[model samples]
Target: VNTHGNTDFRNLFSQLIQKPEEDLELDRAALYLAGEEYPEVDVLSHLAQLDAFAAQVSQRVTHETAPANLARAIADYLFGELGFDGNSGRYYSPENSFLNRVLETRTGIPITLSLLFLEVARRLGVRCSGVGLPGHFIVGLDDTGEYLDPFNAGAPLSMEDCRALVDRMSAGSLEWTDQFLEPYTKRDILFRILNNLKAVYMQGREYTKAVGVIQRMSIISPGLPSLYQEQAWCHAEQQEFRLAIGTLEAYLQEAGTPDDSKEVKDQIKGLWSTLSRLN
Candidate 1:
């Protein structure tokens, strides 16, 4: 690997070593990947390889002699059968881009892939975990007690790859931090799914559904102020001023002061005034 690749691998390894053993639940990774905070599921892993991994396990279960044998077979398949090729580059199914596939399948594409990987690793008795890195989902497995990325089609990465990925997707203002490389749980993964749906709905101009998704997100991450703010915006668009005002107030109380606080607060005041007129 090149300098960049080496850096990415080191960073990934550091992240895996830092994760606590108990927080292996996949849902936690989902929520964090979705950009929501779920403190109850403190693990910081990704759910990215689930679909491919799961498929491999199912096939093995059907034909393999036993679960123990299946695990060994899987390890062999991942390492020996599918040897890492640096020149291969990234692979996406020709039939689907990441975004299009996720959007079209709705429930299965991304989530299934992550789950598949997790199942196979579990069967193999490997100490693997998911890392829900910002803007991407991926897997990390313990090789000699160190975390290695499997989503690079089972290739090893350096810390630079992890940092580059973080820098590539962030809003350009947020700095990448080592804290971001930690592992997360299964519940977190669910929240990530809902958040991704919300983003899609918002982008597609489907405000009502976005609001509904935020509502579900609130159930998953009740402490997040942004979810309430998003719901409030949806209500305002629908002319439900009272509901909008209530949500805005809740958001302001929790979110505190930010560069956009003044505008949000002003919008809240305007909505309250409109609500008074309606009453």
Candidate 2:
């Protein structure tokens, strides 16, 4: 994986998010985020590809056509004819999280595929929303209140099917609720994608990438104490004790008297001790 360091892409991403949530361009934002790992990503090319997809689908249906038929047309075009599907085998690979890679490979995890579906649907004049289930992401048609599982070849899902899916994904640990099917805002989807990337980086012990993801996450939802905590943890993993200590101190300053304050204080002390020995 080419993890080229580029502050330009990062700054572009910051500028992208500064837009009003309604005006934020999800596809462009995602492509920009992918630029962090793949500095050469062409945002306009991918957007054009999405436009082409919608243009193809538009040929099959008119604006006055039934939404169900429109949805079917979209599913058939993207999943059936185009062969876009979920990357189940290497589900955790960071490539699956990038829109540019997803557009190229035509296979991705639930979120990216759903994002593709949503973007295409949006282009085709369909108001589609992201339904973030506990362990999966699917697209919901805002017009008809219908759900489509993009990872599963754009399979239409019933409410009961969603319940069973939640149970299965969580191994019965998570209880079913209607709230799970609520549409996620544009910012929410981007934050979830970043969180997925962060998890992948942390699990692979790629602290630098993980830190970058965490910093972006903080930008999306700033002042979250947990983000600060995770950033400190990544710094510590990289043996950058002073940076970790400073992050934790910043967390302490922002999140005063939280339940985990004592634990964070102890962690700061431990890092300080390690730094003293190293010096």
TM-score of each: 0.54, 0.95
- What TM-score would candidate 1 get against the native? 0.54
Q: For model 2, how does the per-residue alpha-carbon lDDT over 103-141 read when each residue is reduced to its tens digit?
A: 999999999999998888888778889989999999888
Best by TM-score: 2
When summed lDDT is taken over every stretch of 10 residues in candidate 1, the lowest stretch is 1-10
Estimate, for each residue in 200-246, the C-alpha lDDT of model 1 and write its tens digit.
Answer: 66776777656756765665566576777788877787787877887
Name model 1 segments beyond 4 Å from true.
1-112, 143-155, 167-176, 249-266, 275-279
Which is the leading candidate under lDDT?
2
Q: How does model 2 score by TM-score?
A: 0.95
Query: Model 1: how far is 48 from its true place, Å?
Result: 20
> In every candidate, how many clashes are there?
59, 0
lDDT accuracy of residue 279 in candidate 2: 92
RMSD of each: 12.8, 2.5
The whole-model lDDT of each prediction reads 0.53, 0.89
For model 2, what is the error of residue 54's alpha carbon versus the real structure, in angstroms, after optimal superposition? 0.7
